[model samples]
Target: MSKYHSFNSEKNIKYKLPNEITLFWNKGLFDSFIGIDKVNIHYAQFIQEQVECPTIVIVPGRCESYLKYQELSFDLYQQGYNIFIIDHRGQGLSGRMLLNVNKGYVTKFQDYVDDLRYFIENIVTPKSSEKPYLLAHSMGGTIATRFMQDSPNAIKAAVISSPMLGFYSGLLPKSIAKILVAIKLKFNNIISNTPWYFLGQKDYSPVNFTDNKLTHSIPRYQYFVDLYKKNKIIQLGGVTTHWLAQSIAAQKELFSKIVQLKTPILLLQASGDTVVCQQAQDDFCQQLHTLQPQSCPNGVPSNIDNAFHELFFETDDLRNKAITQSLAWFEQHT
Candidate 1:
């Protein structure tokens, strides 16, 4: 089992939602507990009818927490699926600075798998008597893909939104990048580039989610902004050298073996995404075709256009299309 940390601080952290935003009213609670190395895993639950409906566990992207997904949960609830979401170990209100390094850096990709296993066995399964499905976005999609590789039987199905099979940045020679990260990890264990510059823009305030917004409006975004302002520890910059080394290693392993995974999967690619390379998605689907020919009988890829990386949160029309296609796929397989 991985080590978990306990946060005993009593700081009065408050979240202020924008006045223009309307509250999502439902019977729910903000909960946390130590899991997978005692990291404070934070989550929220919305319970409605007690029928044995399917449970959908949503894993968010990097720098995102469960609170940031409240709007998505509301939609799932309306679809009659019980909803549960987690703030991955390094992100959200989970444990901070697990090592002597900044938050959001994990030495091994399997650390996330372990954390998700703990969450599934301890939280999602016990809470409601229902089969579980997974929906992951961005970095969350990477984590979900890794999890499916190891434990294909764990979930009924998985929907990956703009999965980060690879980043959009032009490739570096893998050998050179690995050497640099290995050298840095030996000394510091954690390294970060400057915070993604777009995160700090005034016009791009995290809390500004009107109907035309790129993402959902969550009070926690403003809270995190303030948290980053004061503490500076919560800001997740680009991947570290150690992170890069481990991630590249993991991606290689996943791509080489993903064809063996029998777990049903729905890969939702975003045509307008500028973060992950389209070639990676193409390569992954092709590999699946070679290995699991029955899975892609049409010999064609499934894709959606006119959307950015966060397809589910793109413009209203695109977002609806993503949701419609995803839920339709899930329904077909479930």
Candidate 2:
């Protein structure tokens, strides 16, 4: 219900930075803090001048930095809301875990959840006493879910887009893929002290727009590609065997702990997503619905058709609807 949504995709498909968004980005605050194991975690924020407003805490996906969320943050800020985004460890401007910076790795999946807890308690709550709404995407969704379970009353509401509750197995069945990853991870641990990239995974490389499965809008996709081209610090590649193993273990724990969630949440499913399993999202919602039917309507995600993994960066037509729905969902809880 804000006019800022009209600026991005209404007139033309061409991606032009809006003057207001540019100004917003220019004046935004940037800072960092020491996370678990002394990792320096970077974050960005936009505070409204001389006005108290609701806050949105963005938990970005894997290989995503707060830098990639400029336009999205600007859009939400224009709606009179404060915006905060964190660049998680092993990616973004934050510290990397491996000697090879491009190899995605994490010592423990719970470290992400702990890092978020530190951000909320030490950073977000001090700035805004009001419980902030959570807007998490992909891998961030998994992190947010665990955080909510840990401190259920901390957030007023949440909107998770294309959550990575389950891995997508290309050729092998899910059970077989899990077994393979586990076996490879154990083999890797014995042979090498450091984590190795999963089979067929490599360093940072650009995919052609036509071949990319992230979004449909060429301009929107190009916008992010240009950012990565400009900054080598945030150019992250595929996951390591250890990272995949950690993620699988975390996913297994999530299902067992679903009954602990207390905050209201909305899961937005990308119907065409090949990055994460849709069946997993369905299973999560079905389990969550038995506990809180109002939070997840009818025990399933709110579907977005013709969308890829990156719902926020999708073509205007798709992205706008997803944003509108998320904003409305937050307003309901507020």
**Candidate 2 residues 108-167, lDDT tens each?**
999999999999889998888489999999999999999999999999999999999998
Instruction: Single out the weakest 10-residue window by summed lDDT for candidate 1.
Output: 1-10
lDDT of 1 by residue, 95-153 (tens): 75444334346647777777788777788888767558889988888888888777777
Global CA lDDT of candidate 2, please? 0.91
Question: Using TM-score as the measure, which candidate wins?
Answer: 2
Superposition error at 96 for model 2 (Å): 0.5
Candidate 1, superposed: residue stretches over 4 Å from native: 1-26, 98-103, 171-235, 293-301
Query: What TM-score should be assigned to candidate 1?
Result: 0.76
| Model 2: colliding residue pairs | none
What TM-score do all the candidates reach, one by one? 0.76, 0.97
Error of 1 at 332 (Å): 0.5
